[model samples]
Target: MENMLVTRFGHAAVLVETEDARVLLDPGVFSVDEVFELERLDAIVVTHQHPDHLDRSRADALLARNRGALLLADPQTVEQLGAPWRAHRDGDRATFGSTTIAAVGELHAEIAPQLPRVSNVGVLVRSETGPTIFHPGDSYATVPADVDVLALPLSAPWAKVSETIAFAQQVAPAIAFPIHDRTISDAAYDIYWNHVANFGGVADLRRLGQTEATQV
Candidate 1:
């Protein structure tokens, strides 16, 4: 894959552009303003209904701008979002332009036994001209094989360093990068980064700066 680009917009939001298509993932509240400014998107995928991942307040406007883009979300989120949003469940597949998206995983990681679980579907994206990438939204419940790049969630209420490292080992991608990292402070970022670099079992771990586009 040549000229493939992945641009992070803080936390879990990212823009993936290949030679044939452009896709946006998890445009949550923490995502930067530039996300809304984007046009000509092939698809806008939401992992779940969480405000941090869906950004209900601004979603309508974003969709209005990219009227041609497919709005896909988890089953429960589809019910909540209604028209214009379709369900993307485990084993389901969809195509936008030359990019193919396959849904995997089912539920969000257990935050606690008391809190109810919600649907969360991770997506695997493949393009004829780009590397295969996987983004496991809020869960490590399912591990897909033959991934070229992994969007590893670096921090969250339900995530731990051990599980994060183990998840990376299980997927065993050629390269990995951090996401879901709004909670990390400047002082503590290196601690997490170093641990993953030393033990995550991936050959390369690239830390993306906010809004910076990097080739993976």
Candidate 2:
């Protein structure tokens, strides 16, 4: 569907588009620098406050350019980022033109016992007559229902390959793509990609490179 365009900007940054709305998710530090250059945006969704998950400068640039764009995030992120945002916790839903976003998940995955756990809310975005996609931020929690596409985080401080595989197996979406993957080198990233591609996966594994969009 023309409205269901999903572009991966590396790491966890994703740009989701509909006929009437354009939503950017997690314009983090590791995300492509071009995210700051977006001309039009309907909303920006920050799953958490981590620098690698929420880059304030890019967000500022985007919001500054599109004054009416909404910034949606969890309470902690809205508080920590100190930006004008709407509090979107689990079960809360909002509409942006022709698209709808449903908040999901809660806390981020644990980095360590000594480290503090932060709030992270996954989002389910659905556009008019297009695919429904879920971006789960830094968590491995499964969505309650299967989706058309899933942004699967393949690497992070708080998860393992086995856990990633298990999460995919559980969610069992029609298509799953890698995200949260800037920490690894190209070769190392390939290893993870190969595993996800070749494993006895329930969902169709897809690797969306930087700035690449695929129809789900």
Reference-based TM-score of each model: 0.97, 0.93
| Superposed model 1: Cα runs more than 4 Å off | none
Candidate 2 to truth, TM: 0.93
> Which tens-of-lDDT digit does each residue in 58-95 have in candidate 2?
66777788788888998898787665788889999889
- In model 1, the Cα lDDT at residue 29 comes to 92
In the range 33-99, model 1's lDDT, one tens digit per residue, is 8888889998899998887787888877889889999888999999987988999999999876677
Model 2, CA-based lDDT: 0.83
Candidates' lDDT values, in order? 0.89, 0.83
Q: Where's the lowest-lDDT run of ten residues in candidate 2?
A: 195-204
Best by TM-score: 1
Which pairs clash inside model 1? none
For each candidate in turn, give its C-alpha RMSD to the true structure in angstroms: 1.1, 1.6
The positional error of residue 72 in candidate 1, measured at the CA in angstroms, is 0.3
